[model samples]
Every structure is written in structure tokens, then in C-alpha cells.
Target: MTRPRATVVSLNQRIRDDIEARIRSGEWPPGHRIPSEHELMARYGCSRMTVNKVLSMLAAHGVIERRRRAGSFVARPHPHIESVALDIADIPLEVTQRGHDYRFQLLSRRKRRPRRGHGPEMQVAGDGSLLVLQSLHLSDSAPFALEERVIGLAAVPQAQQQPFDRIAPGSWLLQHVPWTRAVHRISAVNADAEQARRLQVEAGTACLVIERQTWRGEQPITYVRQMFLGEAYDLVARFAPGRPARRD
Candidate 1:
């Protein structure tokens, strides 16, 4: 009797799953080099094309990183960070969850008209005036994040009446307003002098910035820019293979 050959699809998935399992289980830690294509092909009794496809998929998913002439290795995650889900939550609640005391300090509040050169936050104000707020969030008395926000008076007129002294603006907005949609933009930047002073980090230190805009129906509600120390925070997202990500 002759031994049967495994189908290409089955073998490909098998190899991919095995590698993923090792990485997830910490058997292959971050920066651990993956087996070369030739080695994988020989071990799995598969074609070079199949091994390449598996590696390509893993790289695309961020499970591993490929370097020119250096082969592929397990990817390292950001250091000294707290991973968060896609759905951002209240900052005060986040600090409490981390077993730290949370405090808010309102820096400034002003009402101003939108100007052409101000930026997108100002543009969201349309023809109406904006209630601008600046605040800082502290964890265990240490600077955690700095926030700058502008609320569209036409959309959330009540914001002008409330003094955001004890509570952070983001936390207050989440409670009083019902938003139909929100968009988040994340980036990294070196701290400027003012931001460095507020965040208590070196001027040249890297910071993670999250800019968010929320809307009620077609009307803009508020726009906020939050800056956090890069090593102190991280954002994580999980998704299924072949599934489209949620837009909102």
C-alpha cells in the first residue's frame, strides 16, 4: 500500500498554525528568528511557495517582522505600556482599574469664535462659537496625559454651562452627550517644550498622541487631542482573519 500525500491547503494551514502556536505560547519569543524557507520546506515536506505564503501571512498580521537579508523574527511589542482595546473608555476609570489614584486638573476654559487658520477642531465648530478646555490627568499624582478639547456650542450647548473643574472633559462628555459616531487618529511625536512641561517628560521624549472627533448625526459634537508618554501607554487591537475592521 502507498502512503497518501497531504493536500497543499491542509499542509499550508498546518505549518502556519504550528508556528503561531509557538509564538503565542512564548516558545518563540520576540526577536527569535524563524526557520529559513529551506528549513521550513524540508521540515514540513512542502513546496517553497507554500512556506513563503505562510511567512507572508504572518508578517502581514504583525506576528513576525521580515528584514532584508536578516530573515524573519517574532515581532516585539511596545515596552512599559498598557494595552487597550479599540473602544476607548474614560481616562479616570482607566487609572482606577490600574490600581492607581486618579485626579483631574482643569487648566483653562474659554469661549472663542472659529477662525479659518485654527485647524480641524475649529472647522468642526462651523459658524458657531466653541467652548475650549485644557486639562491634565494624573495617576498617583504623576502626570499621565494632557488634553486639549473644543466643543461645538451648537451641538452641545450645555457644555458651556458646566465647569469642567473636578472632572476631565472627555469623561464629562461621555456622560452628558450621546454620540452617533467617532473617529480616532493616533501618531507619535517628540514632545515640544510646552507639551514636555505639561507631561513632565523631556522635551525630546517621544509621546503618543490620540486625536478624536465625535459627532451626533451630521453635527459635530467635540474634538480632542490627548498626549501621553510613549512608554507609559499602548493601544492594542484584536481582529479575526479575513474579517473587515469596524469603521466606527
Candidate 2:
């Protein structure tokens, strides 16, 4: 059954427009399956070829999802995103997924005053801050990263008894404590001998450092410094809908 060129083009445009209208109007919400090609062709008076092209193009643009035996569907919405959000690059996670080895070691814990030399962002009180715990994390028997963390004695009365041998402080806090507010800062730092030795990299080499602090209500909960070994890993992100653009 042959159709005129004008008729083919008209049918194609109609099918594309119909699908686009449904998406813009939210009839096809994210992750919701759309009609199959046969259904779309039947409703739009279009050829299967035209429907396939339209769906394939939309899927490539992150607007839809195509799965074998499942037909086409709107994509899953991304997660809540913040401006100047996380951009983690050069941290390796590939080898571990292959069932490789990983390990952690607790170095020391201390209580200290907010000395002026102790980095600017960490401006705490003179009554002395909570506990500072240091440790190293390894992958495949090679040093992977170093973790330096501060704990809120008031937030978690159990901080004193928190063991650090098998579990890194950052992981322990997240699993055992609860926080309401969190701040994260990422930067580059030169490795000191200790950091260098633990990471198995040359001292003074550039490393990615992430500093994060969390609070429960107005009370501080945790402060942490996480340093990655090198540029073998990076962060990928997805975002959800923003607060309905404020209407005047």
C-alpha cells in the first residue's frame, strides 16, 4: 500500500505533535509507559517507520526510555538538585564491583581547640570542638583514600564508644547518626607525608578533598574531610523537578 509523499509527511507530523502534546501536558508522566507503535500508528494515521523514528529521537534526548519487550515509556524523573552541587571526579569504584578487596584502618582520635591555623572553614568554639577521628580506606590492597572526621559529642552521646577499626568514621556516622542539615565543600590539596604514605602516592601530589559538615536543627552533628587518591573516578548526577517556579 503506497501513500503520496505529502500524505506521508502529514501523517508523520501529526503523530509527532500528538506525542509531544501529551508529554507537555503531563499525560505521559515520567516512568509511565506510552502506547506502542501499533497503537500510535492506528490513532495518528501514520506509518510504523515514522513512529519508530519519533520515539527513537525522543529517547536519545533523555526525554523517554526504550526497552525491549517493554515498549517505550517516559524516563524516570531525576533527584532533587542544588546549585553548585556535587562534582566528584577521579575516585575509582570499578575494580571493587568485580569482587576485589577493600579495607579500612583507624589511626587516632583527639579533642582539640579551634586554633587559627586549623583551616579557615572549620571555625568552631574555644570551649573545644568534639572528637576528630582519622583513618585510611583501601581498595585491592592499595591505598584508595584518607578520611579525617570530626564528631559532635552533643549530637551523639555515643560518639565516645564508636569503634573505628573495621568501619570508617564517615560510614559509621551516616549509619548510626541522624542529621537535618548538611554542607559540602570540595577542593584540591597537596598530600602530606602521612596522607601520601596511606594513599601510596608521592607526597605533595594533587588530590581531591571534600569537606562536609552536618547539623541536626541548629546543633552541629558531624564535620568531615574526605581525600581521594587521584583522578581515576568522577561523579555523575541526575536531577528532579524544581519547586514549581514561584508564581508572582
Candidate 3:
């Protein structure tokens, strides 16, 4: 049986979705040339303007590239993004699950004024004192990650008293605070002398950094930076697109 054709009004959008599906499914992998506008126009029975419009949107979204005299091809695969879980991660459990002995050392715990730029970042009223915890995570006795965190006392007062040595601050905060939101910025950096010593890597080594901020309603709960030796880790994320509702 033949599939019913799309309506005129939905043609452009359906065409766009079909093209994107091919790219996402790796059918048209990076560097693969997509059909020309004329070819696509004939295949989809759409006007040139509609096809061009769809291609422009794809290019703007970095899914395809248009080159003079070269037509368009799938763009080189960018850092793929998958929806991340908002819940706090269990670092020790993650390490142990990966077949390694997990351990951590609480290097320092102190109450200090927020750094020059931290006050605004934390959305606090003043450069007030914050509980800072510095720790090192190890996998099978090898340095895995270094964590530096600052807690807003007003948001989680118990942070001031908790000895993070017994429970990682991340785990502690997840258990104590009712955070409604979180933001994560993942990036690569060249480890400096200080970070190098903390992660037990040579200076100038590449590292993966996760700068995370958590909030309870409008109040900031904590800001932490977890840096790991890049050579020792592979960050993975999985994404599943939303399915259309069933008519039945």
C-alpha cells in the first residue's frame, strides 16, 4: 500500500524533518554530499524557494554546509550533545561500576569570602563567606578527578558543619538540598600547575572540566568545578527524541 502524501502546507516542514533524520541516523554521515536543490526539489515535488529555505535553516543549525560550486555536504560532526540527567551524579559509584576501586580524599575545608567573580556568579547579595571544599577522587589508587566547590551558606547551612570526608559534597548536597535546577558547562582546558598537582598530571596536560551550578528555586545552592585528566576519561551521553503521540 502507498503512503499518503503530505499536504502542501506541511511539505516544507516534512522535507526538513526527513533530511535531519537522515543526518542524525548517519545515513548521510559527515562529509556526505546531500542532494542538490534541483534534485531535492524534484524528489519532494516542492518549489526551489521552499527547498532553499529548508537548506538555509539546516546550514544555520550547523547540520550541513553550502560551498560555492561544491553544493552542500553534511557538516563535520560537532561535539554531540545528549540530554544530560539533572540529578547529581555519584562519582564513587560511577568509578566502582567501571571496575575500579573508588576512593576520595578531602584535602581542605574552610569558610572564605567568595572570590572576586564568584559573588555575581552565585547570585549572592555580597562577597559573603562560603563553605569551600577541595577534594581529590581516585580510581584504583590513580588520580581520577579534582573537585573544588563553593556552597551558599544561606541556601544550605548544614554545608558549614558537614565533614565532606565521610560523604562527597556532591552526594551531600544532593541529599540535603532540594535543588530545582542545574546548569553544566563542559569544556577542555590545559591543566595549570595547581590543577596538575591536584589531578596528579603533568602541567599543560589536557583536562576535561565540568563547571556545575545548582539552585533551589531562585536561591543558589552550590557551584563546583570538577576537572578530570582527559586521557583517562571518556564522557558519554545518550539522547532519545520525543515520539509522536499515537492516534489510536
Pairs with steric clashes in candidate 2: 78-239, 78-240, 79-240, 88-235, 89-234, 90-233, 91-233
Model 1 Cα lDDT, one tens digit per residue, 17-127: 688778767799989999999999899987788899989867764667889999999877645322232565699998899899999999999999876687766767977
Worst 10 residues of 1 by lDDT: 78-87
- lDDT, ranked from best to worst: 1, 3, 2
What clash pairs does model 1 have? none
* Whole-model lDDT values for every prediction: 0.80, 0.65, 0.74
Candidate 2 lDDT over 14-72, as tens digits, reads: 66556756765678877789999999888776778989987875665455789999999
lDDT of 3 by residue, 1-248 (tens): 43345454367667876886786566898899999999999999878888999888667646678998999998774443332343357788788888999888999988877766654444632335688888999999989999988887765554666778778888776544444456778899999999898777789999999888865434667888999899887666544467322210
Task: Name model 2 segments beyond 4 Å from true.
Answer: 1-99, 116-128, 243-248
Q: Name the top TM-score candidate.
A: 1
True-structure lDDT of candidate 1: 0.80
Query: Regarding TM-score, does 2 or 3 come out ahead?
Result: 3
- Look at candidate 1 and tell me the lDDT of residue 66: 89
Model 1: residues >4 Å from true position, as ranges? 1-85, 241-248
lDDT of 2: 0.65
